[model samples]
Each structure stands twice: as structure tokens, then as C-alpha cells.
Target: MTDREKIQQILQGISKTALPAQPSESLFDAGVLDSFSLVDLVAGIEQAFGIKIPDSDLNPRQFDSIEYIEKYLSSHR
Candidate 1:
């Protein structure tokens, strides 16, 4: 699967709901994710992508949406 697909799958698992239609949509604003879910997302991303995410890079802005998460993963990888 593509990176975006993996992200969406991760998000779906965390949110336990359908993802927003827009890839750029803010998960926080859409009520799909919160501070607690962000932690789960980071763990999922790290495990799925096999990359370690440092605590210094754990900003919400870096993971606010699928597009952003893909970009972050690309850069980190």
C-alpha cells in the first residue's frame, strides 16, 4: 500500500471512525483525534514505518493531517 493508505489505515484504527474526505483536513478540528490519540498515532507510525520518532519531533503540527504525516515520514525516512 501507498504511504497515504498506510496513514489512513493507522488513523482509522485510532479514530475508530471514517476518515475525513479531505486529505488536508485537520484531524483535531474534525474531532477524529486528540492529544491522547496523537500518542497512539506516533506509535503506529513508528511501528508501521519502522522509524523512530524522537520526542523533540512530536509536535502536533507535524501530524495534523494525512498529508503532513506523509511529509513527515518522507523526511524522517
Candidate 2:
């Protein structure tokens, strides 16, 4: 799958467990994800995409939104 598709899948996985509504543009700001979910997300990205998430890449900006995660992974991958 393309990077965007992978990202959407990742978002879907998260939404399945934690998010009450479909991910909108403001889901991140709406407290849809917390620290525990952030850790789970990083693990999911690493395993799904076969990419190592380095300490340098571990920032809230990268994890805050699905769009940000897609951009970051697309550039790095």
C-alpha cells in the first residue's frame, strides 16, 4: 500500500480502540490520543512499515496528527 493508505490504516486501528468518532482534522487537538496511545502508535508504525522510530524522531509534532505522521514517515521512509 502507499504511504497515505498505510497512514489511514494506522489511524483506523487507533480509532477502533480509543477514538469515539471518525478521525477529523482536529482529532489530535480533541484529546483523541494520549501518552499510552502514542506509544502504541509508534510501535504500530514501526511494525507495519518496517521503519525504526529513532529518539530524534520521537516528538509530539510527529505524533500529534495523522497528517503529521504521514508527512514524517513519507520523508523518512
User: Per-residue lDDT tens digits of candidate 1, residues 24-52?
Assistant: 99988888899999999999999999999
Q: How close is candidate 2 to the true structure, as a TM-score?
A: 0.73
- Report the Cα RMSD per candidate: 0.8, 3.0
- lDDT agreement with native, every candidate: 0.91, 0.71
> Which residue ranges in model 2 land beyond 4 Å of their true spot?
17-26
lDDT of 2 by residue, 1-77 (tens): 97766766776777654443433344466566667777878888999999899988898767776667777887997
Q: Candidate 1, 60: how far from true, in Å? A: 0.8
Q: Which ten residues in a row have the lowest lDDT in candidate 1?
A: 11-20
**Steric clash pairs (candidate 2):** none
